[model samples]
Target chain A: MQIAKVRGTVVSTHKTRSLTGTKLLLLQFMDAQGQPLPKYEVAGDLVGAGVNEWVLVSRGSAARIDDGMEHRPLDALVVGIIDTVTVENNRLYSKKDAERG
Target chain B: MQIAKVRGTVVSTHKTRSLTGTKLLLLQFMDAQGQPLPKYEVAGDLVGAGVNEWVLVSRGSAARIDDGMEHRPLDALVVGIIDTVTVENNRLYSKKDAERG
Candidate 1:
C-alpha cells in the first residue's frame, strides 16, 4: 500500500459494465517526505474519502479483496483515510494541521 | 502490469517460510520510451527471467494468483519474458537485439 492524496473525482459514465457504480477518484501518491509525487492515478474510492484528504491506496489485484469488488477491473483502490503519518519519530503529516492550514 | 528489466537476483536465505523456494529478482520498470525508471523493485520470479532480460511484471495480490503462491506475501511477480515491445508500429525493444548488443 502507498499513501496518497485525493485530488478530485473522475466521473466516467461509459466504462466497463462491472465498474458502473464505483466512485473513481484522482489521486497523487505521496513520497516519504509527505510531499505529492508527479504522477497521478485513478482509484476506486472504497472508504468514501473526500477530495484533499490523505488516504491509503491498495494497488493491483489487492483492490479486489473487499466484498463485492472481486470482478471489477480496478487496479487501485482507496482503502483507508489517513489521519497522521509519523516517520523516524517525527510527525510528517497531521490531517488536523492540514485542515487548519 | 508493467514492463520491467531484471537487474539481478536477490539471494535471501532467511525469509518467510512460504517464500523459501521462490526466486527473487531485482527489477527496474521502464518508461514509455523503454528507458528504465529510477526506482527498483524486488519480485518473485514466476517465469525464468534472466538478468538484463525485459519482462512483464504482475503486481500486488495478482502475484498470488498463480498456483501455490496463494499464501506468499509477495506483492510483485515476473509473469512473462518479453520478446518485443511495439508502440505505434515502432519496435521499441527486442530481446534478440538486446542480446546482440
Candidate 2:
C-alpha cells in the first residue's frame, strides 16, 4: 500500500462493465516524507474519500479483493482514508492541519 | 500489464519462504513511445527472460495467478519476452536491433 492524495474524481461513462457504478478518484502519490511525487494514478474509490484527503491505496490485483470487485479490470483502489502519517516518530502529516490550511 | 526491459538479475538468498528458488529480475518500464522511464521494479522472472530483453510484465495479484505462485507476496512477474513493439504502424523497438546496438 502507498499513501496518496486524492486530487479529484474521474467520470467515465464508457468504461468496462465491471467498473459500472464504481467511483474513480485521481490520486497523486506521496513520498515517504509526505511530499507528492510526479506519479499519478486513477483508482477506484471504495472509501468515499474527498478531494485533498490523504488515502491509502492498494494497487494491482489486490485492489479487487474487496467485495463485488472481483474480476474487475481495476489496477488501483482507495482502501482507506488516512488520518495522519508518522515517520520515525515524527508527525509527517495530519489531516487536521491540512484541513485548517 | 506493462512493457519493461530486463536490466539484470537480483540475487537474494534471505527472503520469504514462498520466494525460495525464485529468480528475481530488475526491470525498467517503458512509456507508450518505448522510451525508458526512470522508475524501476524488481519482478519475479517466470519466463526465463534474459538481460536487455523487452518483456511484458503482469503486475499485482495477477502476477501470482501462475501455477505454484498462488498466495505469494509477489507484485510483479515477467510474463512474456517481446520481439518488437509497434506504435501507429511503426516499429518503436525491436529486440534484434537492441541486441545489435
Candidate 3:
C-alpha cells in the first residue's frame, strides 16, 4: 500500500454491473515524507474516501480482493484511511510538512 | 512504472459483463532492483503480460482508461511491458541487483 491524497472523484454512470456501486477517486501517490511523488495515479474508492483525505491505496488484483469484492472489475481501491502515521529512524513525514518544504 | 515480476495468475469465472474478455494476473510490486517490496500487492493484467514478465502497472482510474477499456471494474492493470530501466543519480536499480543485495 502507498500513502496518497484523494485529489478528486471520477463518476461513471454507464459501467459494468459489478461496478455499479463502486467509487473511483483520483489519488496522488505520496512518498514516505508525504510529498506527492513524481508519478500520477489514482485509486478506486471502496471506503468512502473523499478529496483531501489521506488514504492507503492498493493496486492490482489484490486491490480487487478486498473482503466481499471478489471477481469485480476493480484494479485499485482505497483499502484504508490513515488516522496517524509514525515512521521510525527520524523518517516521520506528514502532508503538512511536505507542503511547507 | 515500478519494476516487478509476474508472480502468478488469478482465475475468476463469475464476473461482471464488461470484464468478459479481460485478463487478470498476480503481480508482486518490486523495488528498483526487482526485489518485491515490503508491501504485498498485485495488479490486474491488461497488456497480455505473462507470468515472470516485467511490466508497468497502473492503478486507480487511469488503469481503466487504457485505449479501449472504459468503465470496467479494473483498478490495477499492466499498461506496459518494460524493456529496460535506467535511473539517474546513481539510482539505477534492477531486479537482479536487488535480489543480490
Candidate 4:
C-alpha cells in the first residue's frame, strides 16, 4: 500500500470486463512528510487534498482485491482515510497539523 | 501511482520467473496532509520514511512496465524520488518542510 490523495475519480466506460465497477482515483503519490512527489509518465488527478489528507491507495493485483473488486482491470483504488501519523524521535503528525502547518 | 517510502526490498529467489530483478518495497500509505493512514489488511514495509520522503511507486501492469521489467509477476516498484509539492491555498510543501514540521 502507498500514501496518496484522491485527486479525482477515473471513469472508464469501455474498460476491461474485470474493471466494471471499481472506483479509480487519480492518486498523487506523497512522501512520508506529506509532500507531493514528482510525477513521471503516468497521468493522475489534482483532487482537493487541501495540502494534507493522508490517504491509502492500493495498486496492482492488490488493488484488484478491494471489496466488490475482483477479476477487474483496476490498477489503483483509494482504500482508506488517514487520521494521524506517529513517528519516532518524538515527531507526531496529523491531518489537522498538515492543514495548519 | 502513490507515495511511499522504501522501507525494505522484497527478495524472492523461488518465485515467479517474470518477477526477476524487481525491487519490492514495503510501503506505508500516508494521507494528503502527510499523516499515516490506517492499514486495512496489507503487509508492508517500515523501511524508514523518516517522517518525510516523497518517493514514487508504481503498481499493477504499470509497475511491470519499468526498465528491465517485462512479463514479470511484480506488483509494485519504486520508480522515482520526489523533489517538491506545490498545492493551492498558498500551501507550498516540500520534503524539507515535512521532515521539520
Which candidate wins on DockQ? Answer: 4
TM per candidate comes to: 0.54, 0.53, 0.47, 0.43
Off by over 4 Å in 1: B1-59, B62-101
Return the TM-score for candidate 4, rounded to 2 decimals. 0.43
Model 3 chain A scores worst on lDDT over the 10 consecutive residues at A9-18
TM-score of chain A of 1: 0.95
lDDT of 3 by residue, A17-90 (tens): 45556555656687877787745344567788766768888776667676666645556678887766787756
Clashes by residue pair, model 2: none
Clash pairs (backbone) in predicted model 1: none
Candidate 2, lDDT over the whole model: 0.75
| Model 3 Cα lDDT, one tens digit per residue, B1-101 | 34456778777789888878777777777654335765544566655666766665666664665455676777667655554444322333333454466
| Candidate 4: residue A94 lDDT (0-100) | 73
Q: Score the docking of each candidate (DockQ).
A: 0.06, 0.07, 0.05, 0.08
Query: What are the runs in model 3 whose C-alpha is more than 4 Å off?
Result: A89-101, B1-101
Instruction: Give the best candidate by lDDT.
Output: 1
lDDT by residue for model 4 (B1-101), tens: 45444444456689776655544555665454545555311112212222335554555564454335556655554444444533333333355566678
- Encode model 1's per-residue lDDT on B1-101: one tens digit a residue: 89988766544333334556877666778998999786555678988998789999887778889998776656678999999999999999999999999
lDDT of 4 by residue, A20-101 (tens): 4434444567778867684311223222233235676655666545445544333555566776766676444577776788
Of the pair 1 and 3, which is ahead by TM-score?
1
* Clashes found in each candidate (C-alpha, N, C closer than 3 A): 0, 0, 15, 21
lDDT of 1: 0.76
Error of 3 at B9 (Å): 27
Q: In what order do the candidates fall by DockQ, top score first? A: 4, 2, 1, 3
lDDT of 1 by residue, A40-98 (tens): 88989767888998876667776776667788998887666666655334566777888
